[model samples]
Structure formats: C-alpha cells, structure tokens
Target: MTDGNPDSDGLVVAAFGNRGRLETAEGETLPYLLKGRRLKAVCGDRVQWKQPPQSHEALITDILSRENALQRFDPKGRVEIIAANLTQLMVVLAPTPEPDLFLADRFLCAATLMDCNPVVVCNKTDLQHNDALRAALDEYRQLGYVVVQTCAEPGGNVADLTSLLTGHTSMLVGQSGVGKSSLINALVGDAAAAVGALSDASAEGKHTTSATIMHRLADGTRLIDSPGVREFVPNISASSEVQLGFPEIVALADRCRFANCQHLREPDCAVKQATADGDLSPRRYASYKRMKNITASGSV
Candidate 1:
C-alpha cells in the first residue's frame, strides 16, 4: 500500500475480499484490493502491494508465506483461515454463561496443532466463582496450561492479562459474554470494541465482534479480537495428527503395540490404556475422541 516501490510491504489489518486495509511500514493505513486469485489474504498476513498505473487503490501483489495459521472448517466443509502467524492464543471463559470445558479443550488442541502458545483466561473475577468453573480451570492448570484470572470492570482490572500480550502477536478467542471484547478494551486502554452482555432469559452471550480485527498495545504487541463462536473445529488433516496435539497421548503413542494405531479401537493402544490406568484425564481423552470423530467425517 506504500508509494513508489513496485513491491511494497504491508501488514493485512483487515481483509474482506475485493477490499482490504493494509498498514504500511511507516504506520500509514491504506485500502487495497487483491490483484489476482493466487493470494487469499486474511488478518495478520504480511503482504506486498503496489499502486496501479491509473488507479487510486493499491493492488495486493502477494501474500507472504506464513509461519503458521489458525484455521477452522466452515459449514460447507471448506477450510477457512481465522488468523495467521499468531504467537499465542488466549481462550477466554466466564461463569455467567457457564464455561464449556470441551470447547476450551478444542481451542487448546487447536493451539497445539497450530504450534502456538495457549493460555486460559478466566475473566469476570469480580463475580462469585462457580464451583464447576473453578474445578474445570484447575484441570487446565494441572495440564500445564497457563491460566490468568482477570476482570474488566471497576474493581476488576486487566493488568494481569495485559502483561501476557507484551511482545507477541496474540489472538483473543472465546464465546461471547465471556468478556473478550471488554478484556481487549481494558488491555489496549480503549473503548472502541463493542461490548455485549448475556441474555437475561437464556444467559447466553450475544454476538459482538462481527469481524476479525487487529489492535496494537503500547509495547508493540499485536492483538487480534475475533468473532465469538458457539463451536470451533480446527482444520486438521488426519486422525493420527490429532493425537500429536495432545501431549499426554503423544507421550504414550510410541508405546503402542502398532506404529499406525489410531488408538480408538486398536490392540495394545497406550493412549486408551493410559486413560484406563488413570494416567490421562478422561475428559481430555473424550474430547480427543470427539475431535477424531469430527475430523474423520471430513476431508483428510
């Protein structure tokens, strides 16, 4: 989106086909459009663009190769990139709407599959902690997941969570009403993000963030706030690759009798044996099997 250079570098801040916004090296944001069908730019993509000879909008010439990407499958069974080149993923949860431990596990598994650092953010510390919520959080902490307690209200603050995003390009993802937008506002010290509350009747979070957008902290850290979803399925390729996402399963996978064991119904499967021996969390194993089933029905 920059001037003069035929191939200028820019960071894709927001992309919505046909029109996208890019931030140039000098911190200037310019709107541009894709030049061809080769590059499907998404949030957090570093791209190259140039001004067309007789056009006002810059042309996106290229999308650089990404180190990693967080992706999901759409309803049509198409793989979609949610965000790219993220260093960390924060799974936000709250008590009012009741945290879904299975959903949390899915996000954690997605993080592992994407090779990104995962953090569990328990928001709304101001509210009375639900026993079930605390117990679930305890399970995450036991599995070596970094957990942070944060609140984005008057007495409830955001400093603890802000420190985690200091130097990394992080994505904040969770269901609505979990205070993800509120936490983003608090961490970035702004009120631009839309905030929504749970339905009084249903206690379910209202959809707030309609699009994926990026924000920057004062310390040069980039944060992306994504739309809340009721469900999330990573765009993983194979059932065997799913086991690699679970550390406990991977630790025992080599011990299985057969090298190509799926572990669900295979002989001498160490993964299933670990669950029976009480070495692995039954819930995590269950979540693993559920994902295996989900991915098995889709494309490999």
Candidate 2:
C-alpha cells in the first residue's frame, strides 16, 4: 500500500478540498492527501509526495514552485487559486445563459494578467444566434483576441478547439450553464466517468462537484476543467495594473495627457476619448473601470 521510494515528484491532476489525485512521473495516477494544513494544491501543480506507511494514499509533502496561477478573490476577500501553470485560458460563451459579456471580459482580463493566452470560445453554436451576441463577439475579434465558435453536440466544431489545445495546459472558465462541461465531454470522451473513478479511488466522491480536474489529451495537451461560477472577481493586487489586462486601453494609455492617468475624469485621456469616438468598445471600458474600482476598494 506504500510506494517504495521515500520521495517522488508528481503532477496534481485533481483537487477536492484537501484531498485529491496525483499522477506520478511514470504516469500512474494515485489518490493524494495533504501532509499539513498550510500546503494547498490545485490542479496543474507540480508537487513532491510519498506514500505513508500503512496508508493507500500518497501524502503531498510540498508544492513545487508554479510558473503562474489563475486566482480570484473569494467572498471573504481571500485569494483562491483555481489552477496553476496554465498556458491558455479559454473563456467560454454561448447563445444561452444571456452571455455575460462583462464576465467574459473579466476572465479575459485575468488571463492576460496571469500571463496566459486568452481564448474566446463561443460554445453552443448549433443554437440560435442573435445580432447583439454576434456584435459582441465581433468586438472581441476586433480587439485582437482569438475567438473560436464551438458546439458540444454530435458533429460539433470541437476539432477547432482541439487543435488550439494541442501542446498546452489550458483551463476552461466561464459563467454557470455556459456548456463548459459539454465542451469537456466533446473534447475528451468519458471525462466525467474518469473523474468519478478518480474520486471513488480517492475516497472523496462528494467533492467532485467542486473539484478541479485535469484531463490529458493524446497530443500532450492538458486541459483543466474548473467549476463554473456565477460571479468571479480576479485578484488584482493594484488598481493601476488593471489596465494591463485590457490591451486596447494599454495601447491608448501612452496618448493620455497625464502620465499616470486612471482614465476616469482625467483631462484628455485617450482611453476615454477612444470610447467617446467609438474607437474602443464602451462595455469593455466600463468593465475596466469597474474592476479598477473593486481593486481600489480592497474588497470584492
């Protein structure tokens, strides 16, 4: 019931509360338990672990350094790390769920701030589409973001998504009911069953609903499926850095009259002028302002 070696390096493939699963360097997946309360491991984290005597589970001893992590502020203002070492963040949208453009904007902003490539995924393409939604999607495309239309049903355009996910550690994030689960199923068949098996093996079946699970594809792509959230506030350390998340704003910031323009009520602010002159999307500008405000307030 114990691994022979005293220590081994592994990748965290699933996280449910303080218990989860890890994949060994040799590609064996096993249930993992945290050694202490201080070490928190999320999906995509590289960790050091070992089997404890008389226990079937591996004990996670230390979490290795992460290149980057996707984070958000919890309701109580605590930083919650969603996943780590991600190369791409897919912000999924759909015809249904009313398409919260502001939420998508926030996700894209967070992806940019986390140093991950942000991909805009328009799921449920088989459903009806409206002009407003099309217009919003067009705005994102015009802003230099890669937007891919997808459908999770049979014969859906999942190949396009699969091609993008190849050779990268990508995470799908979006509002609840945006078909994130469906996309995962389409991309990786039997993903739900695999998750269930891992949960059962780990003896943590109840935590699967909120657990973040990573799926490995044939082409060396690792996809992390995160729990859908009704609302997500990215953890922004400073108000000024919020603009860095918006590429269009960053492009126009240099033209502002003041060197440190916050782009709110500032004289001759290029960003504001762009929004006024229809050069920038008004909704996106509004989102930036709101996020900046939230960051400044020090509370979500």
List model 1 lDDT by residue over 136-210, tens digit each: 899888778899999988567777787788899999899867887777777777525322321122335435677
Question: Using Cα atoms with residue i matched to residue i, what is each candidate's TM-score against the true structure?
Answer: 0.89, 0.92
List, residue by residue over 126-193, the lDDT tens digit for candidate 2. Answer: 99989888999998998899999999998888988988998899999987667776788788875767
| Model 1 ranges with Cα > 4 A deviation | 1-4, 53-56, 191-207
Question: Which stretches in model 2 have alpha-carbon errors above 4 Å?
Answer: 1-6, 195-209, 298-300
Name the candidate that leads on TM-score: 2
Which residue pairs does candidate 2 place in steric collision? none
